[model samples]
Target: MDRQDAESAVRVLSGYPTEEEVAALIAVLAVVGQAARAAPGPEAAGARPGRIPAAAFAAGYQSPTSWQAS
Candidate 1:
């Protein structure tokens, strides 16, 4: 957004922040906006968990078993 939009939005929020504070807030907001655009979407991040392949338990396979005390 342009300077005008930023200024107008700031006017709506409570408190009377100084010019420096406003500038800092805008700078942080700009970084966050940029990061959000660059980052991957939620769907892309929700990957399914992987399971062991069937071959892992195929014939002659010796899967580790817990030690028995009996």
Candidate 2:
């Protein structure tokens, strides 16, 4: 989504957002959507083969916790 649309979505979801927050939110959404599209799934049409390793996941969660989260 464009910055204005993203900001409007944030406002609809969480009330209101400052200009800086909106920009950050837009960036975050872009990155997150990129990552999600890159992840292994039926929805990941045209994605490369093989699973993305757990290490490729955000670093906070341990492998064991990730297994449990699945």
lDDT of each candidate versus the true structure? 0.68, 0.72
Q: Write the per-residue lDDT of candidate 1 for residues 1-70, one digit (tens) a residue.
A: 9997677567747566668778978899999999999998644756434644455557555544623432
- As a whole number from 0 to 100, the lDDT of residue 7 in candidate 1 is 71
Which regions of candidate 1 deviate over 4 angstroms? 1-14, 45-70
The deviation in Å at residue 45 for candidate 2 is 13
Model 2 ranges off by over 4 Å: 1-14, 43-70
Clashing pairs in 1: none
Model 2 per-residue lDDT at 51: 54
The number of the candidate with the highest TM-score is 1
User: Which digits, one per residue and each the tens of the lDDT, describe model 2 over residues 1-70?
Assistant: 8998776777857967778777877899999999988877853554456655555567655567678988
Q: Per-prediction count of colliding residue pairs? A: 0, 0
